[model samples]
Target chain A: MKQDIREILAKLGGLPVSVDTISDSADLYTAGLSSFASVQLMLGLEDKFDIEIPDHLLNRRSFASIDAIAETVSAVRAGQEAA
Target chain B: MDMQISLLDRLFDSGLLIDTGVEGVYARSGTFEDVITAFEGLIDRFAGNTGAEVIRFPPGMNRAHFEGSGYMKNFPQLAGTVHSFCGCELDHQNLIKCMAEGSDWTEGQKASDIVLTPAACYPLYPIVARRGPLASGGALFNIQSYCFRHEPSNDPARMQLFRMREFVRLGRPEDVMAFRGEWMEKGKELMGSLEMPVEVDVANDPFFGRAGRLLKNNQRDQNLKFELLIPINSVANPTACMSFNYHQDHFGSTWGLKTADGETAHTACVGFGLERIALALFHHHGLDPKLWPASVRKALGH
Candidate 1:
């Protein structure tokens, strides 16, 4: 799971990089995440997981970090499975 | 090989256009250069003979300015951020945690609220009316400004921060229509010149919920907003680029902008959503903007 998170981090180029260095609690936007790169991350999330993200969940909270995003993806997957 | 809309979203069911749908990056970078390029060509073709003098505006504005202009009454929802100071000492980290953990601070209320401007035109009225006017001639301005809105959607197409490049003129009603008319014709030509697959249509602002349903009717009756929509993600629901608006003495009366004869100078403005256009162009051409047609590349000066 951490490996998956790492790979996702790698794909997010032009973020204040060095995926090997940062901890989970670090603030991404204040630490220099450009809004442009965030869209790339969103697209990658949609394509990689092969799941649709609803409009309601489209916000900074869900996209803040690997931990937050992974939780969101798992929750979405679980919801899909439940249905 | 899939060519159906998402039944889940009625608007999404039309078709998904990927290129245009994805140019979110370019749009936020800045929308003015393209708008200016398009406007210059359009004005030369359409407004050249109308004797439109170009005026530039001061960047940014103050809250008192808008209050004086009645912006708070009409558009409270869309006002931008204002800077404010707590006018008190910063609490220690422990104090912050204590408050967070449900401990109340001693004898404290929060600071005052200053405001940011939401519209590009909010500051124009006060400046125009400052000299206690009676100039016989009408005024025309080419303004590019940073505009802010607290919109519901965070779609790249709908952004918190965006740029607006506008052609605004204050004159008689007939003159305002003539400017809009000239831009209307040139709007079609400019879209074609860029080879964007688009249509010109009337649109209403996302005013709100059930009440918003009637926006289209009102917009049509008053001819408020128009857009050139190129499908993003091939979705038939279009994004608005050019918005033409006529403020029939609403702003003029609020600010007391008067002509030599002492009537409110009719105000009209043509607004270009800079980022939206960049998105349209990026999607219409390829994402690798460097590889777009030479003419398009030249048109964008890229």
Candidate 2:
């Protein structure tokens, strides 16, 4: 999940640095991921994971890093299954 | 961006914009004023039979209303408040002394009851909410105001204080959506008549911070906002001359605005960036209005 999320970020993040240089816990915003790029990344992640990120979970912290995005996707997917 | 420098120079040289020695501030010449007036008249002609109630508010609005509008949470960086030197005699003396000494005299000023209006429609919702539920046909308002943003920029198109002509609709979801749709088309038609090549595309407000990114994306994903963009300075990056926005029930929910049927009223607004449009006209049509195409002049009633 982390690798895939990283791949998604690499594709849509528009960050200055290459994705491989950053760790899963590294701050994406600090790596030059802008708000518009983050939103694009969010859209891309939603498409790849096929999970709807609820409004409550839509915050900077949720997309702060690869690990955070993976956790959010897992939680949403888990919620979908439980439902 | 390079062309903008020459355009600004032309505006100043043509006396269309009076230089105020401020980066983002300028006074409009009479011809400039007439052009905006003609543009507004064209808007009126376009909106004919819409039965929109015309409401004009002062440039400043109640500070409390500004706070209640949640503008502070969203775009605090752009918000401007009215501050005055409300001090005692001794403080006033110190203020004078500071001014004479070339010190920060404005530091002695206190925040007043009003804030420079951030948008034309910010004051309308509370007033409408106070009137109870909307009528069956909903409400349509034609409002214009001098909006202020704290942003100071060298770009001539980006003025700190500018005018926005907006048509606001509040009612059922379908009604509001239809209103937005009709204006989006009418806006395109209006620009077409003026010979301004434009494209309407989905847009989002420059929402602030991390949470704002989500809001912006949600807005675009829901197709709530559309902007009619025209190339004034740069073709690669066009400017939004007009915007058609459907707020769904955001404002209604915020202000407890209800429909006659007792449900939250949906709201939408179409705003024309008056100065930007005028700048685009001068940019495309040249600095001289007389030299403009006869059709463009006729369309603008210039």
Candidate 3:
């Protein structure tokens, strides 16, 4: 999951630096990821995971870091399984 | 496309729209004004039976109201705040000196008590909420106002400052949805009468930041918003000339608005982008309104 996230982050344009040096919990916006790029990244994540991110989980906190995104994905997947 | 450039050039050449040397800002010529007025009159005739409370708000609203509206939360980039020079004598002199020296003088201006309205119906909510619960049939308002946004684009259809004519309804979930549905069909018919081919599809706002992406998708998936699009500028990328949105208790929760049964009042609005519609007319019928098709002219009551 972490490797996939890293690949997605690297592909997002407008990120000032490489995603490797940034820690999992580091803020993506502070790392220079723009809103447009974040949207692109969101679409990419949705495609890769084949899971729809619910409205409630769509916020700055959810995309603040790779770790946050991984948690959201896992949570959504768990909910799907329960359903 | 070459057609778009030619259409824009024709509008400028015919003096229908006087360019202001700035992208997305223009002074409408008398002919342009006439077309807008005609279009509005046609809307009025169509809505004559509906007892909509007509209201007109100034281009700017109270700054405090703006801060509380949560507009900055979603569209901070497009929001425009009014500023003025409220400094004393010494500060004024300093500002003048800075201007003379070709330095930044605008920094001396402070934020004013007013902010340019981003949407036509923004100021209506809190006022309506203050009136307590809505009546049995719900509340309906006909509002028109000049809205300002910071989007500077070369597309004449998209202006930084433009007028929006909106009919806002607040009531129960079913009532608001019904109203939106009725208007969705009505808006399409109105456009067709003008001989403009329009397509209605679910759409989303350009929300702010990462959360905005989610909100946009949620809005689209839930079918909260729909737009009447026409191929004005380009056939490939049509522009939205009118929009129908269902804010299902979003404003009710925000403004403490309630229905007669004490539940949060659901809200919906049908907004017509006036300039875009006029531009669509020009695009479809060519530069001359007089030479437009007889069906279109009769539709506009020519």
Candidate 4:
């Protein structure tokens, strides 16, 4: 899941630095991920994961890092399975 | 809500504003114009010595530049584009016929090269970039323009077409942030002189749709925007009379604006909503400018 998140970030994050160099907990915004790019990243993640991220999770903390995004994805997938 | 509507009605009845048969659109009387002119003079008194370049743009800007600004991406709901009837003679006849039939004649109108200027400082970015890299001391501009937004309301403060006076600063991030900070204080002082109630609070633009929620959150979390609020329509939900924005290389990267050292420039702007302030004064003081407090009149030089 972490590698998938990184792959998505590499494709759509528009980060200045390489995703490989960034730790799972590294702040994506600090690495030059713009608000515009973050929205793009969210859409890309939704498409790749086939899970709809709710409006409540659409926040800075949810997309703050690769680890954070992975956790959000898992929560969304878990909510879908329980339903 | 009743009080808000009455205020609009009173302004129209007092001849301070002329009713234009459209909500949020009104023609100002001469007295209102005088007040605006006097307030503008006061603004100049505060900021004129900064040696900022003065540039005034028309209410409409180049469509291509507006597209590049990414305004549509964020607030597509509020953007207004200029469209013209570019049909041939045959199509013109059809358009006339459509109009005569009391149908929608505007369907054939094509998009023009212009879009209503959403904010005063928007047109300045591309122009400044064309001047090449900024000087070591950086650049400051005094800009004013009639701005447009699509939100129509009975609240007189929320005009569909209004004027914005802005001071834009471009330089390193620290310089830009400092500029915004200085204006935030100056804004408070100016309002203080008028003896008006004011509060400064972190704010965000009305970014559009679901994705926009993230953008709005990030903006607030970063403290990128602030507003000086004054009660005009309601005290509980006061209107934003002034806004200070720190773009932090958003415009710099978009416009290719550069600092002297060849780094991307950071930009910040402080904007004053002229009509909103005038309305706030009337709402807080009195409908009659003559009856306004002596200090308030003196502050505005009325």
lDDT of each: 0.61, 0.89, 0.88, 0.94
True contacts kept of 1: 0.00
Instruction: Compute the TM-score of each model's chain A versus the native chain A and list the values.
Output: 0.82, 0.96, 0.93, 0.97
Displacement of residue B119 (Cα, Å) in model 2 is 0.9
Write down the TM-score for model 1.
Answer: 0.60
Scored by lDDT, the top model is: 4
lDDT of 1 by residue, B96-115 (tens): 66678888653344423445
Pairwise DockQ winner, candidates 2 and 4: 4
Judged by DockQ cut-offs, the docking class of candidate 2 is incorrect
Looking at model 4, give its docking quality level: high
DockQ of each: 0.01, 0.11, 0.12, 0.82
Q: Order the candidates by DockQ, highest first.
A: 4, 3, 2, 1
lDDT for each residue of candidate 4 in B217-240, tens digit (9 for 90 to 100): 888988999999999888899999
After the best TM-score superposition of candidate 4, give how far the Cα of residue B4 lies from its true spot, in angstroms: 1.8
Q: Compared with the true structure, what per-residue lDDT tens digits does model 3 show for residues B1-302?
A: 57766777888999989889887889998878889999999999877778899999999998887888889878999999989999999999999999999999999789999999999989999899988999887899999999999998778888999999999999999999999999999998899899898999999998886568776865776698999999998888899999999987778978999888888899999999999999999888988899999999898888
lDDT of 4 by residue, A43-76 (tens): 9999999998888899899999998999999999
Q: Per-residue error at B4 for model 2, in Å?
A: 1.9
Order the candidate numbers by lDDT, best to worst.
4, 2, 3, 1
TM-score of chain B of each: 0.74, 0.97, 0.97, 0.98
